[model samples]
Target chain A: MEIIISILLLSGSFFIFLSALGIIRFKDLYSRMHSTTKASSFGLLLLLVGVSLFFNELNVYVKTILVVVFIYLTAPLAAHAIAKSYREKDKE
Target chain B: MAINNIVLLLSFSFLIVAFILAFVRLLLGQGIYNRIAAMDLIASIVIGFVLVYAVFIQMGLYIDVAVIISLVAFLGTVAVSIYLKNNTNKNDGDNH
Candidate 1:
């Protein structure tokens, strides 16, 4: 189970790293936002799950889960807002 | 119910890779906005690293720090965006 958890976590983080690299390599603001949003969201979610497994406390697990949920809900909205502003600015 | 040491090793390597990519962005970005965006990525990656560290070290406070970092990153991005827009507008007005 631990190996399973680690595989999940590492895979997600690898994607996160790739995404951040894409952010640097991509020239457009929209493209960067896409990479950041998808990669970090999954990466952080895996991290939270890995921590929860490593520590068997109920409170911390719940809190970690909540944080993951909140991030999922908020990250896309934040990215959208940023992208919208960037596009609007480009238009002007 | 026990975690393998290999898991820890893999997680650490992944984090280091992410950190390096984010660092490259921070160093090589062409302008203020790009740099700011890279900083945002750094903060996000740092939060992941912090959570993993908390697990390895059995520290609860690290999650609290991650929470605070998230809040601050959001605000900082907004503040920088406003500043950039305002500065650009001022430059545009000056040109006219």
Candidate 2:
């Protein structure tokens, strides 16, 4: 049980680190947005799952699931807004 | 138990590194869009930090904090984007 939890947590952290690295290293604005929005969301999902597993409780599972769902629903919308605005501004 | 502690510590270190990298991008980014995107990334990273801390201390309250942070971050991003779009439109109208 502990090993599973640790693996999930560590992998999630790694994905987040990769996203941050991508944000810095990517040359274009759209590409940076692309990297961050997806990678970080997935990382957060993994972390939440790991946390829920560790606790093994009803409330914790519900809370983590809620957060995961919320993030999944909103991340792309936020990215789209940012990208759309950037395109509109670029047109000027 | 010792191994679990080591894993948690490593996870925290990774998150810290990610946070610092994102901060650097926020500071040195070229434009408003880049900065805004970095800010969004930072917010998610903060959520990760909160979750790890929740696990570390064995408390559930921090999860609630994560939910609120995510909500605020999403709203801030959308608001800034709308503001940017409106500003562009106003400028275009003035030119016409």
Candidate 3:
């Protein structure tokens, strides 16, 4: 159990690190948005999973799942809004 | 026990580094869009931080904080985007 939790947390953090790197290194605005939205969402998923496993309680499971669902739902919407506005501004 | 502690430490360090990188992008990014995207990324990183801290201390309360932060971040992003769109339209209208 300990090993599993540790692995999940470490990998999640690594993915987040990757997301940040992409934000800094990606050349184009759209590409940077792409990197930030997808990678970070996955990273958060992993982190929440690890937390759920570590706690192993009903309430923890529920809250973690709620957080995961909320994040997955909103991250893309936020990205889309930003991208749409960006393109519109660029057009003008 | 020792390995778990080390793993937690390492993951926390990773998150810290990620936060710094995102902050740099937010500060130095070229355009408004770049900064907005970086800000979103930073919010996600902060969520990660909250989760890890919760695990580290074995408390469940912080997960609620995570949810709230995510909510705020989403709303802020959408609001900024809407404002940007409206502001651009106003500018174009004035010019034309």
Candidate 4:
């Protein structure tokens, strides 16, 4: 069980690393947002789940679950707003 | 125990790599939007790192910190987007 948890966490970390690479490598604003928002959001969610899995304590699991929920609710909207602003800037 | 520690260390290293990637965008980004986006990405990653750290260190407090960080980042992104929108409009007016 511990090994499984570790694997999940590492996978999440790997995806985060990939998104970061995408942020640096992508040519433009929209594409960068595309990579970072979705990839990192999923990565963080997985990481949080891994944390909950590893820590059998109820409070820790609850907190980690909250973090996951918070990210889910916020990340996409933030990225969209940012991208919209950038597009508006381009039009001007 | 040894393997777990190694995995944890590697995850931290991955976070560092993410930071470096964001730093590259900060330095070489073509525009203010790009830089701001990079900053936003960094903030999100930091929150993830905090959550992971909380798990590794077995602390519940860091989760609260992560939540606070997320809230701050959301507000910061909104403010920045508004400012960027207004600033660009002002520039357009000046050019006319």
Report fnat for all candidates as fractions from 0 to 1: 0.43, 0.83, 0.90, 0.70
lDDT of 2 by residue, A15-91 (tens): 99999999999999999998998999999999999988888889888988889889999999999999999998887
Q: Residue-wise lDDT of candidate 3 within B11-36, one digit each (tens)?
A: 99999999999999989989888898
B1-84: candidate 4 lDDT, tens digit per residue: 213788888888998899898899889989888888888889878977886787678766677787789889989998989988
True contacts kept of 1: 0.43
Chain B TM-scores, listed for every candidate in order, come to 0.89, 0.91, 0.93, 0.88
Query: Which one is best on TM-score?
Result: 3
Give the count of colliding residue pairs in each prediction: 0, 0, 0, 0
By summed lDDT, the worst window of 10 consecutive residues in model 1 chain B runs over B1-10
Q: List each model's interface RMSD.
A: 2.1, 1.5, 1.6, 1.9
Q: Which clashing pairs does model 3 show? A: none
Per residue, candidate 1 scores C-alpha lDDT tens digits across B74-95 of 7777777777677667887899
Which tens-of-lDDT digit does each residue in B33-76 have in candidate 2?
A: 99999999999999999989989998877888998999999999
Where model 3 places Cα greater than 4 Å from the true spot, the runs are B1-3
The better-scoring model by DockQ among 2 and 4 is 2
TM-scores for all candidates? Answer: 0.85, 0.96, 0.96, 0.91
Cα lDDT for residue A79, candidate 4: 87
- Number of the predicted model whose lDDT against the real structure is largest: 2
Worst 10 residues of 2 chain B by lDDT: B1-10
Residue pairs with clashing backbones, model 4 = none
Residue pairs in candidate 2 whose N, alpha carbon or C atoms collide under 3 angstroms: none
